[model samples]
Target: MPGETVEASAGSVATRDARTGGGTAWLLGSELLTLFRRRRTWAMLGALALIPILIAVAIIIAGPAPTGRGPAFLSEITNNGLFVGVTAILVAIPLFLPLTIGVVAGDTIAGEASHGTLRYLLIAPAGRIRLLLVKYAGAAAFCVAGTLTVVVVGTLVGWLLFPIGPVTLLSGATVSVGDALVRLLAIAAFVTVSLLGMSAIGLFLSTLTTVPVGAMAATAILAVVSQILDALPQLEWLHPWLFTHYWLGFADLLREPMVWDNFIDNAVLQAGYLVVFGALAIGRFLTKDVLS
Candidate 1:
């Protein structure tokens, strides 16, 4: 039954490809639709959007958090509402952000398999490689969307609840609201890249089994463990190697001149993980016996 559907549909798939000129755009679009159409995707996104709202509301009620009382940018929020997004990003990066990403990426392949649609997808024109790439692309899109959800919502909520004006950089230099917004976008980009490594890992894990939950849990756990290792002073040597090492380094983007060192290093580290884990996922998926 596993290979039967693919075998039977191979000819039809080829015919469809020939008639349609064999474009992959449709497959990718369909994948994205399938991914976002599910209620789970929006639920996770909604949860992420709430981080900044709750933070802003609590700050309004309780007054400015005592100096050094909360996340790095929290104290600044009471002065300039713009920092709300940054602070929310800082709070979520440790666990919440990755948690949502894990749910999406882990469900990439395993969810389809569990639903018995994987075999049909692998029939022809959308071969193993094409499907894998489309799946990864969908997951990556979610990363960007998820990050922006928190950022945009935080910005809006902060503006409405508190006074917004010039943003002071960590270097004590002031920048206009427009410039600060550009920096916020840059920070969001940085956070999106930071999640790619985890997405790739989740993709690989999804290829290993049909249980989406297992892959999702493993991906989130790995993120937490990486951060834990990054925190331990004893593991200083290992810190640079972990994908999460430079997560909070987005703070550098807020400096007067905007430090690019951590940004470059983080991109390179995440890229390495992406390549390694992406290859592993491809290998496993190509050889995997689809019996769902």
Candidate 2:
């Protein structure tokens, strides 16, 4: 019996085949696990969490800000803690959010190649398209995570440091705490979606080279430049097409009737960028040689 080794069972091989054929979910989970496990990811999240804490602390120390003196909804934080999350989002949307998204998305493929693991990943039986989708999904997951970090942390920090009550909308309507919480979550979702275009751009750039830092910088710079262009009066004609144009449109969700025009416009703009850059990344990656 010791000399005659038993052969592998047919069921085992069939099970392995099935797993290999339907492993996209497994791969995505592994990708997200790997992403969140990195210290850099946590560090970025911690930095984001500080935004609200610092805002709340400063407001507490400096006394209530006069209306129209600071960030929108900042003065309101003295009355309702919920505004803290919204105000933090307004502060972060300009640069912090995009900076973090750039790092994650830019590192997607390039990080694997930089670590000399790209070849192994491809040989893991992951099709290029599948792998690319998983990478984007991972980046997208980080977007959600990062945005929620600010919102939830901001809310908690605000609650501990400020009063909680009904929030007044810009349109002269007040809403209950429960309704305001829903709007805060909606704002977070809008902020997350706002970063997708940058994510796609970063992913495409990541495929261009093995230098993750370069891709990250380019992605961040593009975000800054887009905003600058959006701010230029002479370039007003191009504002509608710019990805950053509708970023702050999350304010629409806070309105009494809740305007949907900006939300719809931003979603359409982001989707267009996703399609164009996603296709480009796919084309470049599928044909490129994976030397690493």
Candidate 3:
């Protein structure tokens, strides 16, 4: 018995399965807990919440009446989940949300590497791919939370300070406050998916570098470049292919009858990015030697 390798009994195997499942659950829960416990996370959420409030106050002080022309100042600021909860999804998608997600995700793997913990993680029975997936899931969860925080806080602040009636969209269509709220939620969901692709890209980049700062900076630069490329008029043919291009597809949700063609296209494109980047991250994480 001392020299023999004993196979696990059926009861032991069942217990092991239970433990593995519990470990995964704990990993996810602990990651969320750790993220929220950080002072930076609270500070970031507070700052985002203040953006819409500050903008609403600025509009009120300026004394501009709501108009049917473009989005009313209040509506623009409270766009919530629609874009940055700002006027247009196009502007907010590139302007703020991606940067926020990038910073958090970009730091994911690299932060562990920088601290010399990645090697230990890789050595664990959970394996490198599973570890990477856990980190990705954690980062994506944070992105969703951050985006929702901005939308919910901004909307409440905007509604309290400004008018609470129908909103006029850029397309010159009118929608009731309730309808606008629904649209805003849909936009938020879309924006969350869009940012998930960015999160995956950031996570992938994070795996390629040990310096967390470098990963963060590279992700931001990539996002900025992608946004610029998305804006080019000459690249009309390539616009649909750019991840940043469809970020504003949420605008379609605001239009009467709701344009599914472009919205669905954007969703599909973003999904593609998510899949590709996630696979790349897992592949590199599994194969790369973490000598550090």
Candidate 4:
């Protein structure tokens, strides 16, 4: 009875300790501040802002009236934000999203190692799992921000240059401006989720290599490979499992009634990748001997 009493007391204490572990909010905040302060992050944001501007300028230079399914190209982009957003995702995800997440997450533990601060941080009261979670949360925030930046900037520029009237659907149907805007937002949200899979892959790679460059390079290579696999018609069966495959599901938003089958399947696939890779990252970080 006395031994049982001791075990119960210890269990309660452990539970309390876990609960009191500093919330993820502080870690998330710290990660965000670090990212915002970096000149490269600002530079990336600036470059993304330029995308729509360039599109607008090109349209202007060509002297073609705006054309979507309707009279204006801007209307096409807006009404079919799913298409525009997916286009942006296709372009950005391969190069930009992974690079951005890798820059931050790759630097996460390695930056600390490079600066000779990793050991000190490890020695701090925070558990390795918690610290890793903080790093991941920060990277994930960057992923969300980066994806939204592309969507918002692209949409805004497209609207400014083209007509901001009602949207014409691909099915020869028409919708009001307000309805188009709502659909665009939905599409943006979907793209954001798809981007998170890339972020998780980047973070996992970050944990594997001590050199930030190596981590970045590895992440990029993995992305490239995934894209290649997705493109192979022979590998049709594997397409649904690849994170890059569903990256275009945002296109579904443009379809009337929206195809939930592929979109939902993609979400499930991405979620599986996130969980598996995230666990591996945490496991590696926890077991790693921080000699640096």
| lDDT digits (tens) for residues 185-218 of candidate 1 | 9999999999999999999999998988999999
Report the Cα lDDT for residue 286, model 3: 77
Candidate 1, residue 288: lDDT: 94
Question: What C-alpha lDDT do the candidate models reach, one value each?
Answer: 0.86, 0.86, 0.68, 0.66
lDDT of 2: 0.86
State the lDDT of candidate 3 residue by residue for 184-276, as single tens digits.
Answer: 777778778777778889999999999978888888788888879878898888877777776766667777866667667777887898899
Clashes of each: 0, 0, 1, 5
Tens-place lDDT per residue, model 2, 1-292, is 3211111122122224335765888777767767776668899999999999889999999988898988888888888888889999989999999999999999988977876667767766778998899899999999999999999999998888778998889899999999989989988888888899889999999999999899999999999999999999999899999989999988789899888888888999999999999999999999999998
RMSD of each: 4.5, 7.4, 8.5, 10.0
The TM-score of candidate 1 is: 0.93
lDDT of 3: 0.68
Candidate 2, residue 190: CA error in Å?
0.9
Winner on lDDT between 2 and 3 is 2
Candidate 1 — which residues are off by over 4 angstroms? 1-22
Candidate 4 residues 27-70, lDDT tens each?
45545666666666777777766655565565567654355332
Candidate 2 regions off by >4 Å?
Answer: 1-22
Please identify model 3 stretches exceeding 4 Å from their true place. Answer: 1-21, 65-91, 168-175
State the lDDT at 150 in candidate 2: 97
